[model samples]
Target chain A: MTQPSEKALVPFVSVDNMMRLVHHIGLEEMLKDLADYVEEDFRRWELFDKTPRVASHSDVGVIELMPTSDGEAYGFKYVNGHPKNTAEGLQTVTAFGLLADVYTGYPVLLTEMTILTALRTAATSAMAAKYLAPKGADTMAMIGNGAQSEFQTLAMKAIIGLKTVRLYDKDPAATAKCAENLKNSGLTVVSCASPQEAIEGAHILTTCTADKQYATILSDNMVGSGVHINAIGGDCPGKTELAKGILERSDVFVEFPPQTRIEGEIQQMPEDFAVTELWQVISGIKQGRTDARQTTLFDSVGFAIEDFSALRYVRDKVAQTPFHEDLDMLADPDDPRDLFGMVQRAKP
Target chain B: MTQPSEKALVPFVSVDNMMRLVHHIGLEEMLKDLADYVEEDFRRWELFDKTPRVASHSDVGVIELMPTSDGEAYGFKYVNGHPKNTAEGLQTVTAFGLLADVYTGYPVLLTEMTILTALRTAATSAMAAKYLAPKGADTMAMIGNGAQSEFQTLAMKAIIGLKTVRLYDKDPAATAKCAENLKNSGLTVVSCASPQEAIEGAHILTTCTADKQYATILSDNMVGSGVHINAIGGDCPGKTELAKGILERSDVFVEFPPQTRIEGEIQQMPEDFAVTELWQVISGIKQGRTDARQTTLFDSVGFAIEDFSALRYVRDKVAQTPFHEDLDMLADPDDPRDLFGMVQRAKP
Candidate 1:
C-alpha cells in the first residue's frame, strides 16, 4: 500500500509520552506554564466561541463532548464521567482531545487528555485561587484527597507560592495514598483525621471529592471568614460539596454562568442567585477578593476553554520534540476528486 | 517509558488500512453490505439518540461534530467541509470518527472516515432508493460527477441492479474522470454534455454538485414523474439543488426532519412543508412509492445515525483482521485513584 502524504498525518501524544513530557518539563514547571496559558486565555475570554458541553446521560454514566474555537484553531475534548468506574478499577473520568485548523478543517493534534485534563483542572483551580485567595495565603486544607488531590496541591504551590498542604479524606487509604505521593515535595504535608482538623490555620480550602450525590463536604459553620474556598468536586447536577448556607455567606465566582448554573455548586441556589464571572476578575474588569474579611469561593466545573488552552500549549510544546508520533489519520489524494480512485488503486 | 496496558490501547484504522479493507472486501460487495447495515439501523431508528450535528461555521468553511448513541455504544464523527480546499489540491471534506463503549466510557475504535463517509453516503442514498424508486428502474442519470459520483453510481448498481449510468458535470473533466473510473464496473456508462441529455431514459436522477450556493442544478421541467430524484448536493443552509417548483410536484422523503429542514433541498419550502421520514418507511410504519406515477424525491443531508452504523460496521469488520493498529490513547492506572502516582512512577 502507498504511504499517505505528510498533510494527512496527525501528531498524537500517547499516555506514556504525556507522562514523559510532564517529567521532562518538570511537573511543577509544567503546572506553572499551564497556569500561565490558562490565565492568558481566561484574560481574553471574549474572543472565544463557547458552548455548554453536549452530554449523553445513561443509566450508568454520562459521556460529554466539550468544544470551543478561538477563530484560528478549534479544539474539543471527549470525556466521560462514571463514578462507578473506580469500583471496576477504572478512572472515574478519562478523556482525549483534538485541535484542528479552522482554515482547512484538518486535525493538527490529537493527544491523551486524561493526564492533560488532570493537569489543566489543577492549573485552572490554582489560577482562580491566585485572584480569589486571601492575600499572603500560605496553607491550603486539601479535602477529599483522590486522583486530583496531588495535582491541586502541586499547582497551588507552583502558582501561589504555597508553603503547606493539610490533607483529609473520609477514606484514610486515599489520604495515605495522596500524602505518600507528595511526601518528597518541598511543601509541608500534614494528614488529618477529619475535615475540621484539616482546616486548622489554613488560609485556603480545596475540596475535590468524587461522589455523584448532593452530600455537603463543608458546612456553613465549618467555613470561617476571610478565607478562600476552592470547590472543584461539586461539578454535575445532583453533586455538590458545600451547603447552601455556605454559598449564601461566600461571594461566589464562576467560569461560565450558563454552565456553572447547571453543573457547579450554584445548582443548589435559586435561578436569581448572583455570581461573579471569573474572567472579569482576570481581565481586570471586575473586583476580586474585595476585602480580607469577605469570604470568597471559586466554583470550578471544568470548561472547554481551559481544555482549549491546554491543547494549544501541548501543540506548541510538542513541536520538534520526541514526545509525539505522527499517525496517518486523514486521506489526501493527489487529485482532490479522485478519492475513490485512490482507494481503488490500493487493492492488494 | 513503560508501555501502556491493553485497556489503554485503542484500535485505530488509518487511511491506508481503510482502503486496504475496502479492497480486501471488494468495493461493490462492501457497498452492498453497508447498505444492509444502514437499512437495519433505520429499521430500529427509534432506539437511537439523535441530534442535529453541532456545527461551527467559519467564513471559509464549516466544521461539524455528529454524535449519536445506541443503548450500548456511543459514536461521533468529526468532519469538515471546506469547498475552497479543492483549489489547494486537497479534499473538500475530511473526516475521522470514534466509537466508545457506553458502559466503560473508554474508546473502542478510532478510524479515518473520509473514505467510509463516501461509502456510507452512497449506501444511504441507495438504501433510500430501494423503497422510493420505481420498480424495474435500471438506468440512472448521475449529475455533478465528482468524488461522490462513482460511489453513488456503483451503490445504485449494486443495491438496485442499476444497468446504465449517464454522467454529466459542468466540469467536463470531472465527468470524464468519473466515467473512466466506473468503466469496468459491469455497468454500461455514458458521458453526456448536458443535464437534459443525461436524464434521458433514466429512472433515477442523482444530483451531487458541490457549490455552496442556492443555485438550481435540476429544474422542474427537467424532472418527470415516475422517477426517483436522489439529491445529495445542496446540503447545509444556503445550499439547495432542485427548484421549489420540483419539490412542490414530488413526495419528499427525508432522514431526520429537523436537520433536513435546515440543510436539505426542502430548506426552500415553508416550515410546515409535508415530508415523510424515511425510517418510517423502512420500518413499515409509513408508505413509500405508492404508485409508479407518483414523483419521489429523497433529500439526502446525511445523519449521525448513518455514521454510527458505519462506525459500528467498521469496528466489527476490523476485529480480527490486520487492518488496524493499536493506539495508546487512554491512561489507565493500577489504582484508579492513583493516576498521579502512575505519572509519578513513569518519571525516568
Candidate 2:
C-alpha cells in the first residue's frame, strides 16, 4: 500500500489530543491565548464573511453548521444542541470543526471542538467582561454551573484578574462538580444555594444554564447596576436566561446582530430594540460600558468567527507541538482526472 | 491508552475505503443502487427539509456546505470547486460528508465523497434520463470528458441501457482518456473531434464541461426535438452550457426551483419561466414527456436531497461491509458536565 501524499492528509486533533494540548499549555494560559485570538478576530470582524448559522431544527433538538471565512482561511463547526442528551449520559452540546485554506480549498485541520468550544465560549465571555465588567471587579457569580463554569472561572482569573467565583445551579450536583473542578485552580470557589445568593457581592454575573426554553435564571431585581452580565446559555430561538426587565435595564452587547436577534437574550425583546455590536466596542467605534453605574450585558450566543479563531489557534498551536495526527481524508489521484482509474486499481 | 467507546467514535470511510466499497459492489451495480436510492428519495421529496447550499465564494473558487434532513436522519456535504485545481494536480471538486442520527445528534458515518459525489451525480443525471429520455434510447453523446464523464457514461448504461457513448472534449487528450477508460465496459466508445460530431447519432445529449463562464457547449441549432439533454456543467451562477433558445424549446425539469433559478441552466431563462419539479414527475403528480417529439431537459444543479440520499446509501452499504474504520472524533467524558475535569485528568 502506498502512503497518502501530504496533500491528501488533514491534521486531526482528537479529544485526547485536545486534552493533552490543554494540559501542555496549562488551562489559564490557554484561556488567555484563546481570548487573545478571539479579541484579535473581533477587532478585525469586518474582514470576515458572516452569515447566520444554517440550522436544521427537529422535534428533539437542532443541528447547525456555522461557517465563516477571513478571505485567506475558512472554517466551520458542526455542532448540536440537545438539552436532554445529558440525561442519556451524553454531552448536551457536542461539536467538531474544520479549518481550510481558501486558496487551495484544502482542509488543514480537523479537530474535536467540544472542548475547544468550551474554552472559546468562556474566553469570549471573559474578554467581554474585560471591556464591560466594573473596574477592580474581583468576584464572578456563575449561574447554572455545567460544563462551561470552570472554564469561565479560569478565563476570568486569567484575563480580568478575578479572584473569586460563586457558583450555583438548579442541580446542586452540577454546582458541586464545578466547585470541585476549580478547587485546585487557585480561585476562592464559593458554592451557593440560589442564583440570588450567588450574585450577592459579585461584580460580574455569568448565566450558562442548559434549558431548551425560556427560563429566567436571573431576574431584573437580582441584577444590579455597575456590573457586567455574561449570559451564555440563551442561545437558540425561544430559549432565554435573563428576564425581559433585566434586558430593558442593561446596555446589551452582542456578537452579531442578526444572529443575536434570533437566538440570544435579545430574542425576548422587540425587533427594533437597541443593542451594541461587540466588534464595534472592541474596535473602539462604539462604547461598551459607558459608565460604572450602568448595567452592561454581553449576550453571547456563540459565533462562527470565534470558532474560526479557536480553530485557527489550535491549528497554529498543534503545528508547534505534537498534538495532531494526519488522517487520509481527501482523494488525491495521481492524475486528477484519473479518479476512476485510481479506484479501479484499488480493487482487492 | 484506553480505546474510545462506540459512542465516542464515528465510522469513517476514507478515500481508500470508498474505492474498495465501489469495487466490492461493482461500479455499475453501485451506480444502479445509487440511482434507486436517489429515485426513492425524490419520490418522497416533500418529506425533506431543503435549502440552497451555504457557499463561501472567493475570487478563484467556491466552498460550500450542503445540508438536508428527513425527519429521521440528517446529512451534509462539505465540498469545494476550483476549476484550476487540475492544473495544480488536484481535483476540481473534493468532498466528504456526514450522516447523523437526528435522535441523539451523533454522527453515524463520515465518508470521502469525492468518489461518491461523482457516482451520485452520474446516478442522478441518469435517473432523470430514465424518466425524461425517449423510450429505448440506446446512445449518449457526452460533451465534456472530465472526471465526471466516465461515471456519467456508466450510469447511463446501467439505468437507461445506453449501448454507445460518443465522447468529445475541447481537449482531445481528455476525450481520449475517457475513451480509453470506457473501452472494455461493454459500450461502443467513439471519440469525437467536436460537440456536433459527438451528438451525430445520439438520442441522449449530456453536456458536462468545466469552464466557469456562460459559453455555449450546445448551440440551439445543434439540439433537435425529442432528445433528452442532461445539462450538468452549468451548475453555478453565470455558468450555463446550452444556448437559451434550446431551453426555450424544451420541457425543463429541475431538482429545486429557487436553487435552479440561481445556479442551473434556467438561470438564463426568465425568473417566471415555467419548469416542472423533478419530484412531481417522479411521484406521477406531474407529467414527464407527453409525446415523442417533445424535447425534455434535466437542468440538474445537484440538490441537497440527492447528496442526502447518497450519504444514506453509503451509510447503509458500509454497515454491511468492513470498509470503514472508527474515528475518535467526539469527546465523551464519564460525566457530561465535567468536561474540564476530563481534560485535567489527562495531565502527563
* DockQ score of each predicted structure, in the order shown: 0.86, 0.71
In model 1, how well does chain A match by TM-score? 0.99
TM-scores of the first chain across all predictions?
A: 0.99, 0.98
Docking model 2 quality class: medium
lDDT of 1 by residue, A200-318 (tens): 99999999998889988999899999999999999999999999999999999999999999999999999889999999999999999989998999999999999999999999998
True contacts kept of 2: 0.71
The candidate that wins on DockQ is: 1
Question: Model 1's DockQ?
Answer: 0.86
Candidate 2 Cα deviation (angstroms), residue B65:
1.0
Per-residue CA lDDT of model 2 for B1-348, tens digit only, reads: 434567999999989888888989999999999999999999999999987799999998999999999989999999999888889987788899999989889888888889999999999999999899999999999999988899999999999899999999999998988998999899999999989899997999999998999999999999999899999999999899999999999999999999999999999988999999999999999999888999999999999999899999999999989889888899998888888888888788
Q: What is the TM-score of chain B in candidate 2?
A: 0.98
CA lDDT of each prediction against the hidden true structure = 0.94, 0.92
Q: Mind giving the per-residue lDDT tens digits that candidate 1 earns over B1-348?
A: 677889889999999999989988889899999999999899989999996688888998999999999879999999999999999877789999999999988999999999999999999999999999999999999999988999999999999999999999999999989989999999999999999999999999999999999988999899989999999997889999999999999999999999999999999999999999999999999999999999999999999999999999999999979999999999999988889999999989
lDDT of 2 by residue, A53-162 (tens): 99888888889999999999999999998887889987778899999999888889999999999999999999999999989999999998888889988999999999
